[model samples]
Target: MTATSSPLFRPLQLGPLNLPSRIVMAPMTRARSSQPGDVPNALMAQYYAQRASAGLIVTEASQVSRQGQGYSFTPGIYSDAQVEGWRRVTEAVHAEGGRIVLQLWHVGRMSHASFHADGLPVAPSAIAPQAQVWVAGDDGVGRMVDSPVPRALSVPDIAAVVGDFRRAAANAMRAGFDGVEIHGANGYLIDQFLRTTSNQRTDAYTGATLEGRTRFALEVAAAVASEAGAERTGMRLAPFITQRGMDCPEIIPTILHLARQLDATGLAYLHLVEADWADAPQIPESFRAALRQAYQGRLIVAGGYDATRASQVLSDGFADLVAFGRPFIANPDLPRRLAHGLPLAAFDPKALFGGAAQGYSDYAPYEAVAEATA
Candidate 1:
């Protein structure tokens, strides 16, 4: 199908914002925030502004607090400087008529001890993810290091973290974000709390019952929605992701139950992060149908989607929007390129993280590239 007639180019009403297209720019951590304070900067602003053609842009995950950090150079939403820094990004995107939302994050046990003051990451339980996080040394060299056993969060600590999420939502609004997305996916803090394999606690947020296992995630959603307004708040979930020792047989049901609650609360949308790597498990069609039935709000599906697959999914009524990750990194005008069936550019792997502007904002739009080639 041609660009103008494609379903992917259709307009969407996402919450209070009227999106011009159904293409979304999924959140991907580039880890290029200003050092020392882990704050967003002008370079990041330039990077996001370049991709303004997306119907919606979910900014890279920003930790709600210091304890929520997992990798070096990831920005945070807990400080004044960070809020101001994000304002520049929102302003730049707005100038180009792009809509953007901030993704609030807490990495849980997917972290190195170097990020914590007490040398311990906190999770729903003390279990280790058996994964590695990228930590940079004093000399600015980064390497993957094993994640250590985390200290389980206390009841009080859970309340504190929920409060942090609330504050982060308020901070996001102050920073001029069009909305906020709670990062409940990818085996992060909320994901850790939802799965029995990671959350073995016997407390109210235990992994035994579906209600208990979903408590933390629900609380965070309610709190953030309250602060950011339910119409402007969204949450990302990874129901089928099994990496980082997060394989749980009950995760699918747990997510569906949580979706019902979010639906009742009038959440703006639920973003599902499907497995994208080679030979990754395919998300079942039954699950998608069930999710669509359970939640009445808009749904966005991301991972390994090209124009054909994206349009098919939308035609099947499984998802209202499709988010592209790596494609947006290399093609600033990703929506236009996809709509026009233009060839995509490959992103530089070396400069994917902790870099200045070489691979971050140096990518040219198709018009510029065509001009250069000519």
Candidate 2:
């Protein structure tokens, strides 16, 4: 592609954020945060700051509360110390001329009994997710174990979760994030409430109605947006196949409903995670078209997108921005790589989880190698 025609290089405006290009660095969980989940260290800051060239950056899913944690060594935004630590990270990114948005999240029943402080894992329903969780137990490190069913939430408890999101948003701003993304995707708490099989409650949050399942998400958006400002707020939704559910008929209407409500909020963007590596069916393409119109703000499409596909989708106007996750992990200069059409480095999947700094900060940028050779 020529310079004038490069979709990766063209500047784009996402809500009030004027991005230098359409390339976005998707949020990825590397489980490399400080131990006991206190804060993100200098190494973490360097990691993000190095990749600041992307048009926009979405930090990994951060636990809004201790109960929101689902994995080991991930960061949190609920505590003062955590916020301070993230402030350093944001400073580093901004110093490098990059903007970042924090992804606020709660793992819900996705957590294990051992991870919770009070030894209690929260969930929308008492039913076990039938999924596996990676825990850190004795004998060095813990492995993937079957996920136990979570306790059903009462009406009052639902209200409390909404408050958690609000406080998390406040903390994100204190930490210097340009924006905040409510984690409504994946098979987490928000997704559990939205899906039918997980949320079988007869309460107002349940039933087959769109208002019932989507009410919780709307509440989160409304609460978080109040703090982050509609132009600085966004959401990530994996309506297709996620650790949540793939083939549900309910996902369509729920997403459509969210787009309609979110459009009115004047949020910056709605990140759609559509993964093709899964074994189940995909989200109907028609929904994307509907969402394209349903949401008036910027739309970011993430997951399994290459340079060619991203450009084509952007040209087709299906998405305003395209986020690359795994590629970003292995290539800090991914935007330049796509622009110059260079081959990408392969990532070590095993090292992607918990690690010191090997896979985390050791990835070399394109310029470093070029300078060395020259």
Q: What is the TM-score of each predicted model, taking all chains together?
A: 0.99, 0.95
Candidate 2, 104-188: lDDT as tens digits: 9998888888776666678777877778777777764758877676778889988998999999999999999999988888788
Clashes of each: 0, 1
For each of the candidates, the C-alpha root-mean-square deviation to the true structure, in angstroms, is 0.7, 1.7
Count backbone overlaps in model 1: 0
* Error at 94, model 2, angstroms: 0.2
Q: After superposition, how far is residue 364 of candidate 2 from its true place, in Å?
A: 0.5
lDDT score, candidate 2, position 143: 81
> Please, what are the lDDT tens digits per residue for candidate 1 over residues 1-374?
98878889999999899999999999999999997899999999999999989999999999999999999999999999999999999999999999999999999999988999899999999999989988888989778899999999999999999999999999999999999999999999999999999999998998999999999999999999989999999999999899999999999999999999999999999999999989999889999999999999999999999999999999999999999999998899888888778999999988887878999899999999999999
The lDDT per prediction is 0.95, 0.85
RMSD of 2: 1.7
TM-score of 2: 0.95
C-alpha positional error of residue 47 in candidate 1 after TM-score superposition, expressed in Å: 0.4
Clashing pairs in 2: 128-149
List ranges where model 2 is wrong by over 4 Å.
139-142, 242-247, 278-283, 370-374
